[model samples]
Target: MANHGPSYGLSRELEKKNQARFSLDEAIEVLLWVENVTQLPYSCDPTTCQNAADVADLLKDGVHLCKLINRLLNNGSRAPFNPKPKMPFQKMENISNFLEACKAYGVAEISCFQTVDLYENKQCYKVIECLRSLAAVQLIMSGFEMESIIWLWKLATSCEI
Candidate 1:
């Protein structure tokens, strides 16, 4: 009812001929050939033609051929390749409206309601100004010459406001 047999055999001659089909250089050459044929201009020449007439002719013909190739490659369908879909104008308008509402609610004034809050808000514009002010106060508290604090204050204020 059943027969079992050796399904296959490779002779020494066949074994020697059945090598891996492609070398690394051959694979690279094939890829390069495909890339060259598929790319715009399709010419192997890397340099732009120097003659004005030749350059103009090449550009004219190249543009037409590129369009033809692109049509064929895309099967006459053009699809955008954007990674992110565009947001609707309505959504952006809503965000702007929200921010305007917050501003109208005096959210900005909350940032500078107290002395500490005022200092915190002010330092956000320039850390060097804050550091100089702190260093001056420390020097004054440590009984350093008052001239140093005054000099630092003058130096800090001299910068563009």
Candidate 2:
């Protein structure tokens, strides 16, 4: 439970290796893509990470994540949950809800991440992978041909919110 970075320089090398997998740029792109697909009541900007505790801070509450799942699952017109989470446990519940929604939407279990990954600010790449997978699923369902899949992902990554 003590994931506040390396305790000392002894683990710095290992920490750096792990940090290399967390792509802040990719995370932002995923967040922006989710934002573009859903009709969020809140204007949670993904680019505010310069002051955020974690890249997933904007999604820490899990409200938008649920919305993203709802959108991906073709439930964009309705809310999967109604909790206005403020407590830590509530935030965790939202994350859990998002994961459940992912499973329901046919996302591979391997692509889904654990709650602590986002809640504790760890393993951000997992979150991005899940989001990208969801986006791909959404795009493919929307009639994108097989050849366009690669280009679609590149387009989504290059797109700005």
- The 0-to-1 C-alpha lDDT of every candidate, in the order given, reads 0.31, 0.71
lDDT of 1 by residue, 39-74 (tens): 643343324333222222222222322232233232
With a 3 Å backbone cut-off (N, CA, C), the pairs that clash in candidate 1 are: none
> 41-136, model 2: which lDDT tens digit per residue?
445567765522456677778888887777656554443564587688888888998888777777788889899888876676677787777777
> What's each prediction's TM-score?
0.17, 0.76
Clash list (residue pairs), candidate 2:
none
Score residue 66 of candidate 1 by CA lDDT: 28
> Model 2 clash tally?
0
By TM-score, how accurate is candidate 2? 0.76
